[model samples]
Target chain A: MGTGFLDAFAQEYKQLLDSELRLLVERLDAPSIIKESMIYSLEAGGKRIRPLLLFATLDAFGIDPKNGLPAAAAIEMIHTYSLIHDDLPSMDNDDLRRGKPTNHKVFGDAVAILAGDALLTYSFEVISTLPNEFASADTKLKLVIEMARAAGTEGMVGGQVADMEGEGKKLSLEELDYIHIHKTGKLLKFCVVAGAIMAEASQSQLDHLSAFAHHLGLAFQIQDDILDLTGNQQVIGKPVGSDTANDKSTYPQLLSLEGARAALSNQINQAKEFLKKTGLNTNLLREITDLVASRDH
Target chain B: MGTGFLDAFAQEYKQLLDSELRLLVERLDAPSIIKESMIYSLEAGGKRIRPLLLFATLDAFGIDPKNGLPAAAAIEMIHTYSLIHDDLPSMDNDDLRRGKPTNHKVFGDAVAILAGDALLTYSFEVISTLPNEFASADTKLKLVIEMARAAGTEGMVGGQVADMEGEGKKLSLEELDYIHIHKTGKLLKFCVVAGAIMAEASQSQLDHLSAFAHHLGLAFQIQDDILDLTGNQQVIGKPVGSDTANDKSTYPQLLSLEGARAALSNQINQAKEFLKKTGLNTNLLREITDLVASRDH
Candidate 1:
């Protein structure tokens, strides 16, 4: 896999998104500390994979990816809120994320929780207030529906609950798959489906892209597990092997390390097959798939 | 202050909202505990004033209050989620709400937090997926925007941060009003505006109704503070004077008790004046406003 167009596309959009997200929060007549905490975690450097996927999906359809800016920012807010809440002392209790103090670590736990809640609530507001020129009310409503479901109980939150319950127990592959599919996969799929919606793609095209995202989601999580075992602490931004330390189940724990690698490869291949079926300019998506499968962090 | 019409209307709509809220949580295919936690708080027996206000607003427009059910449920969910988070150990740390153990007490902090997150997310989904037969996409989109703004940073969450920061400090009347208006007043106002939007009222009507709601929200919060200081613990469902115990400023604290009562009366009058200006069938709203001003809890 070559790091060709994805880097240039990502660089342009990531900068646009970073500023757009900042302005969105900064302009709110809210309390300063909460705004600071929200911007702090949001600016915390992750790969911005979810927003990139959304922009890339639009790019795949030969559309200007900037049209999806509000949706991308909304989705990133949801993702960022989940991370903030997940790192709370009551939850993952992590002190560092992306090599910086977690939201709760810098702000008190109370403010951190409120910051997450504010971000989650703001995501919907961002979409609902999208300008008429960007999308119709119908389109905005659809985006909100998709976003809410992907982040709510039937998706990421549900996955988090199941993962929490499955801790300290030997989990079956099927159970692990259920967790990953709902937790990580649903939102990734939403990113693609949202792009297709914005592009007014046919139902068949949306269906194929959704399938591509599903496989890509699992492959992404599997690589996450693999990276936990083998990636560097400095690169990954948190201590490696914390999943093992917590005695939680992972792809590498259920499947052997080599087996997890093979599964990741299989998922990547399946994701590519669905991308091919979409019959759009999927080169960007195809490259993203390879990156998810092989990312160092 | 006749209770005749308000009692009958309240009983019928309150039951409808309670069951509808339950069904909304029950139907999710997510984990049982999270669902149970969500439902537990939904059933925790508060007045359901937000939903009632919404239903009453529609009734004022001579529209069937039933048409407002989904939006009613959505607002109540936002209200309920805020309560759950407010009772978290990091925040208020209260064990009791409405005479029952708070959500975190029964479900644990982790599940309680997720339950709040899930409810908040689902509220947007509920509005976005409103059946086309009931409302047009334009209406739903507007409803989402109003609901999100009322519940998000500029409204409830912003108010919460201010309230949290003002704890154990001397707060001026202006500062206290700011907290009440944002923290409680915003969602309350959303209920009324949502009803007008759903009924497709004219901009003039919406503006009047919004002003009415603003005053009503302040009256409601002032009465809440009065109750906390003077009402019975059994009747109010929590200990009286928790506000004083926490060193939080209240209407009665900033103004003398007699002065607070006078202020409450002033707001109620202002709220009614706006309602009368709208020239709708505001009998129901007038009655509910009276009820809010005098409620023990």
Candidate 2:
């Protein structure tokens, strides 16, 4: 079940990221409700895939993954914030995520929305305030710039808006690609690119790593589409077919299930090819790409 | 009617800030609704007090206000985003802002929410990616860290949560101050501290400027509470008594109108004392403080 190195890395990081995240929010000295709402969502937990991707990219670059902890946590906070907002009643109206009641379901829409904002805003603070030992101030600035661009209108939020407007309408493959690329791919690409940036990877190296992430993200999304159709609710955490219920267009819905699976395989292959071109140690990166391509959840 | 220096500076920067802000969003190749929602709130406009404060602080420290344009615009974006979210149905539920329908009323809830998110995220990008001449990466990094701390849970968002939780409870003056300081003071304080930071002012200067901002912010909030009690609907751009109608606490509600006025006067005086201590070219900052203390809308 485990790709030995990847599993070991993830296991070590999950606890570190989790505890660090717990301390970050706990130290806020904020109102109890806001903290509770934030913690509830944070603690409900997911696969920590974004952080792992960040760590893998660092590992591939021969950078110590531990030094990237703040950036790792920052990206995960961003990923988590997006999930919280996406599950809002006005958005997906989702009641469950990660096998737990959504943020809004438990904390009410107002606090949930605020909790999301807090997490999003705090992510930058965590990164921006990192000591020079982690990364130079300039490097941190680049990370912040890249993160904001990826998470802002040109990225996740814009993609979310497009997703909302496109619901109940059949979306073309091009349109779906826009949604997936900006919605999910941009930040995923950021994960790898940020790792490269932190490690002072050259432009050539950054480009290859970015290309790897672009394909990996698409492959991951396609796999998610497949899992929604084929995976059990218990395994997937949320109920299956929720996308269809929300009138969302998925790859499997646009293409046949077999076609979607083929797309996934193609994307994964492209991702691996890019990794190979990076000409760096990519054992963890390759295994994670494989894991993403095959994960049921 | 005008403090000559403050008025000229405000007029100059207001146009520059507004038009620059317009161009920043215009360049974003985002989806229409999201862009529309963001611009609607942004262009609807307000005092632009935050930007003016940024410029005034720079002017005081003998730095080119033009050099601060990106940061000024960034802070305004953050202010606008906070307004958009604060006006959402799930939040303050206001339908009017700057004499126009709120973002949610114009673009619906989801777009409004995402637009706010987009604005907040992009603000950092604006600062982080500023050309090297305007500020160093370390300075930009500091600006981002300060902005996030002021705008995140322990600052505006936390204040917002407290505001929500305290509604209808006839909060004590101390409780009300907590909301005002976190909700309004933090960001206002950032406006000054960020300017000094960018200017590389001496520690003594930064301390005096921070103290000035602290008092000015408290005065500003007190005046807002007063306006909600006595100002015209058309002048204020929103209904008077909405705060009371929502059963929220205010300075006047807790301390009586006369007491609130006395408090506002005291705050303004304290602001001036700090400014006098700075002993820098802070005439513009002092005038702006006076303006905030007396502005009708």
For model 1, residues A91-186, the per-residue Cα lDDT tens digits are 998888877889999999999999999999999999888877778787888889999999999999999999999989999999999999998899
Candidate 1 lDDT, tens digit per residue, B120-223? 99999998887787689999998888888898889999999999999989999999999999999999999999889988999999999999999999999899
Compared with the true structure, what per-residue lDDT tens digits does model 2 show for residues A152-269? 9999988888887788999999999999999999999998998899999999999999999999999989998899888999898777887887788999998999999999999999
Off by over 4 Å in 1: none
Give per-residue CA lDDT, model 2, range B163-247, as digits (tens): 9999878788888999999998999999999899999888999999999999999999999999999998889877899788878
Two-chain DockQ for each candidate model: 0.91, 0.88
- Worst window of 10 by summed lDDT in candidate 2 chain B: B1-10
Model 2 Cα displacement at B69 (Å)? 1.9
C-alpha root-mean-square deviation, each candidate: 1.1, 1.6
Per-model TM against the reference: 0.98, 0.97
Model 2 docking tier (incorrect/acceptable/medium/high): high
